[model samples]
Target chain A: MADTDSSQRVQEILTQATEELKSIKVPNDDQLEYDLGNLLVSNNNTLDETLTRDPEKIDSYLHNLARDSIQALLNRVWELPSERIDSDIYATLPKPTTRLPREKPVPKPRPPTKWEKYAREKGINNRKKDKKVWDDVLKRWVPRFGYRKIAAEKEKNWVKEVPSNADPFEDQFAKAAEMKKENVAKNEFQRLRNIAKNKKIKVPSVGVTGNEYASKNELSMAMHHAKHATASRGKFQPELPNEKKVKGLGKKRKIEFTTGSGQVEKKRNIEVLEKMDKPSLNLDGAIHKEIRDENVAMDLKRKGGKVYGRRSKMGGRHRTKSDHKSLKLGTGFQGKGKGKGKGKGKPKGKPNVGAKKKIGGPKMQGKGRPAGKGKMKGKGKGK
Target chain B: MRPLKNEETVLVFTKLKKYIGSNVRALLERSDGLYCFRLHNGRIYYVKEDIMKFAATLPRDNIVSLGVCFGKITKGGKFLLHITALDFLHPYCQNKIWIKESAEQNFMYGNHVYKSGLSRISENTPKYAGVVVLSSKDIPLGFGVAAKATAECRHADPMDIICFHQADIGEYVRNEEALI
Candidate 1:
């Protein structure tokens, strides 16, 4: 009778669990089955076989079972005495130790040698003495036993030593010096010759002359004359006389000087003056005749006659108003106007027709107004 | 390894104490200006200017996001690196983190980042790179990889490889706790 009552109670619990599972939604489709399978596997036979057909019912059953089982297991473990369990584990463990193997004493790290100590302190090993050498080519002190040593040595010894006496350098030097001196002299001579040629003076021939002193003097004089001639070539004035005059002497001294050689009385034949006499002027007729001749010559020249003063046919004194109007009897006078015929008797006083009037009085003469004052009622207004 | 404290100042101070010596003390302490830590011993062996510069160059918050370590690569070559500073760089360096190229690039990149006033390191070298510190004999002492190299390793400490690599087991691990 008790087993029947327990079975009915389990059935009632499973029914409530199925209702709870149906209420809860599965979060993911793919893992839902796996989750439900895991729940059923843990519960095994504790759930009713009908719950397997419906996963939702099985889920609730497994969930409650897991919670109750976990709690029961935890309670059982907690009931055990802590000290008893610790002792049991301790007893099974290996023994503890305070010391370890000495580790071979670390091979007793060898005490650093003197050099090693120095190197450690200084941070590098000292270089060897034989390794340092002066590199003449590089002009520096460098390691002698390195890759550049051979090249350095070769550069250092590239110049071979020659015996002093075996060299002909002295003779060569002397020859060069002599040549240089000759070249300098030649240059100087050429320069002087150029200067002479530029001055238009002839260069002296390059040879010894028997009259060396005379020739030198002559040459100097010639050069002086050439310079003087060149200086005065375009000038035309004579030098002033250098004689000095004696001032304020007596008349007797003057008379004595004059009588000494200037007043010699030697008689000689005197020459007579000759004159050619002719008639004087026949006044009236001669005056008229001369006037007629001048008029005739002037008229001829004006008529384009070949006269002495008519070389340039267009010659005349600039025309005054009277000269412009003076009409020649046979020549036509085309005066400046609209007609070929003569204009009204050559207008007088500059033919004042188009002449600009002189701009002097009233209109242009008045000061309009005083500056800084209004246009009307000023002191100089209309004056 | 024990997780490092997040505070930059405390971490720097602790590193200074650990590597320089426990006897060292903070000589001039100022986070705003320049901070100096000195050894209390009479010799007063102190952290160098370069170390302070390196510390100042670090990103304020993320310094411990990556582990860092310092030691003399040789007698004169001192180095500092994030445990992950060279993880990506190691393959290119033939897997030897202490080699000259690695050390030099680490220092050079560190200095470049510092000079640029960048909180983050650069990535590509030979272009946006820094110079490496070399010994008198031209051996690399330390390098500075751009902060980008560390970032590429998911911000892992470069020195962590040296600490956790299998071959480093006997040499680096003092105990089982060290492996953790």
Candidate 2:
């Protein structure tokens, strides 16, 4: 009976323990248990003894234990608050130093001196000497001084340089030669002037005289007589020995003209008719005949007129019946067709006919339809 | 419940285990009420609160194939009331138990509570004890461990077991044993 009580007491104690564990809250028990398990296994401790007295209590006891241990640890950690850091710790950090000193200033360059400017100008002047030398070598020497003074000096030098060995006779001979050349030139000029006078006439310039002389007739007559004698001898006629002999001269022939009335009349010189006391019809008739003959000849030579052998048969004749008839026929054909005579086709009429035909013929037919349809249909209907 | 500390966590699970025995299962419960399972095999595991509040937390959709088993195992002169299978637990919880097989793999004794299995509940009578079994195949690797009845207790209010099995059975199958 005592052993039974002991067993009952133990059971009651276990029940009480389970009730108490249930009252305690277990937070994140699974993870806590895992961590605790790892810790135990690493420390070489058995998990069964630490967890429960029997397997029935294993899961419940482990969960409660894990919860309690984790809670206690968190409470302990929270109890000791994190320490605060000092504010002055930032001051201990190193500070940056100042930049290095500025570099020394570079020196400025100086300007050119006055002597350099003067030397440059002199160098430019020296280069101009070539131009001066070129001018001197050309020998177009304009005197550096005044021209009058230079000329006077040159003349004085010439006078002073005259030599005594230069011969006066040689100078005289040169003057005589020059005078002879001048006399010869004068004579040649006079001879040319005389030849010109014989041809027609001209005055000589040897002496200036107010009076002028005319040619004599005797010289002229002698020249004419000599020319006649030579011409008679050249003819091969026998000359009469110093005697006068008369030879019959050919008689002048006269011409006569017949009037259209069949009356023969003597021909008078046209010039004599003009000098006559009375005006004559014969000369007027002759002039008219000549003018008519020239006109007929020109007409025959005109385009398409009949041509005779040497002279025109129609010369000096008025237009005959046939000629007038031909002229009328030509005038009629002037603006009309010559037909097949010239081997050319009929003459063309006005050019506007073709255009007029097109506009009036089909154009009138096109108006029967509306303007747009008709014009469009015409294009579509074309071959 | 207060937040758990690092020292308290070590003292209850890691240090206290040396004073008691090695069969104890330790865990930490989270503030969001998630249960973390720590087994004797040095593995840490987790169970969501919204899955199975009275048992181990897990997803509601995963409850369709859930199973649980409870039993006893005496080790190191301490009588341990052990939970052998609870398939509805999260993968983290299975890792914490440090079992050779996960809830999705076959049961440890060749018994599956989801299809045809035994009950996981147990009596608190003398010479007989209750065990809370929680497991899942949601975790595919590693292990975890934790203490119970401390602030870090997870999955249940008062943990009842000293040791639990939390393991990714796939990992064991891949590494330790080959398939027949």
Candidate 3:
């Protein structure tokens, strides 16, 4: 009785949504930003709209609603950036008025195909490479990045000495990774449990252990078989019904395209219709190719070879006890053999099989007759 | 190529029943959807409609077959959303953004939300949620993909691109329905 159900799950989602809505409705500066939906929920506890009788509540609500129109004035900005915005925290919203260009991409110079004999005359030799400049201007000093330079500058004795302290904490990424592993395990367990419940089957213990690779092989084989079966079914599925459906849905469209000469105009889709019937429609005749493979598989099996085939355990969807019926239903495969001894028309005593059951109300017989006098019988019982 | 395994089908069914209402039979309602189910290489694939051929080239087993997405494949693949799922979940989803009547008219003609065309947005629309585009009367005008977080959108002007209109399943769809 205490187990969780669909309704309870829905309730949980509703509660979560309500909590989120509460965040939006947090009464900014004592002004209630209540919409008409909120009014109904607060007063009537339903989505049904009704007239508000309380003048004070109405006044406050109207005032807040008017303030929402201030969002209009908020949109009128003096200076805003044209570039795409990635984020906007409440404390520091990005605005072109105050924003400075953060990065300018440096153009990378490609090496020349051939150095000119008069390169010095062409002013190409005026530029000094970073290595040359470093050796000439700054001796015994390696180039440091922006942050490293700042750190080195701050390491002087003139600065105030701060007390050394340390608080150890795992990186957020590492913490999240650990938590995510647990979450993955929990979710997998839940999925397995659900599958077991649905199929009314018992689940094995949580670990597959050594059977993992074998299971993978089996799963892939099943997938291949299923894929082939789908291809065949789709290729052979009746297209006539869909053609009729198209014609039926376009009765008015046909009328709209009537020629002035009173002759019916063929739709432009005739070419498409022809193309669909062609081998090009079925993935360039992959369906027939798969069918050939299946036939080959059948022949190989008939030759008593223990080779990889469609009927093998790895291939095809794993059929359950119930699905086994679908594999054999009404095909007269085994059902034909059952009725061999008996006549074809009808069975001996089974009334429902043929025209043997007597229809309508039962006939009154001599021994089955009841006594007349319904009014007297009721009065007698009452007395 | 093969029918779905009992374990696989049952697992997917349970998920659909939870995320969608129990009334939707999903795989059970149609024998076609059930019989053609594929559990290939650990991934589940069922074609209700559209381009499901991508299942053949699926990279891994992490997918839950939402349905067949016909268009662009992302870094993850077409974000799985079955038509049945879309239809069943249309109302409850908080990611749908409704536009004004004027914008709705132009939206079907290939113009998305211009300035002064916004009407309403559904609840707690999170970052990168697939959004259903709705007209003023709340009829679906295909779908949109949110490009930014809420805080970004809140600070953005009406002219800014908050969502990228993806598929156009609107009045324009009527002409193609009969042809195919």
Best of the candidates, DockQ: 3
- lDDT string for model 3 (A1-383, tens) is 44568779889999999876623222332232223211211121332133356655777665644454343223322122333211211122242333335455776554332233357557676555453113233343433545344444334322333334522443544555689798999778766656565566744432352235445444444434344476564465444333322122234522221112111111222232334335645574787777656544533332223445444456553333323553466322111111111455433222122221334322211111132211111011110
The Cα error of candidate 1 at residue B114, in Å, is: 41
C-alpha root-mean-square deviation, candidate 2: 61.2
Clashes of each: 22, 95, 8
Worst-scoring 10-residue span by lDDT in model 3 chain A: A374-383
What is the TM-score of each predicted model, taking all chains together? 0.12, 0.11, 0.22
Classified by CAPRI criteria, candidate 1 counts as incorrect
Best-matching candidate per TM-score? 3
TM-score of chain A of each: 0.13, 0.12, 0.12
Q: Which candidate should be chosen as best, given lDDT against the real structure?
A: 3
Question: Over the stretch A1-383, how does candidate 1's per-residue lDDT look in tens digits?
Answer: 99999999999999999987643222222221112211221223345778757878888876765555544433333444443320121112223233436634555554554446678998996665776777656788866677877667666665545557656444554555699799999778766655665566755443342235556545544444444475566254343366222332236522111112211200100000001012445788998777655544543333333445333358553222333444443333322221111235442222122222333311221122232211111111121
Query: Native contacts retained per candidate?
Result: 0.00, 0.00, 0.00
Among all windows of ten consecutive residues in candidate 1 chain B, which has the lowest summed lDDT?
B37-46
Of the two candidates 1 and 3, the one with more favorable DockQ, higher being better, is 3
Interface RMSD of 2: 90.5
Is candidate 1 or 3 superior in TM-score?
3
Estimate, for each residue in B121-158, the C-alpha lDDT of model 1 and write its tens digit. 22322221222323334443333332233334344443
Report the poorest 10 consecutive residues by lDDT, candidate 1 chain A: A265-274
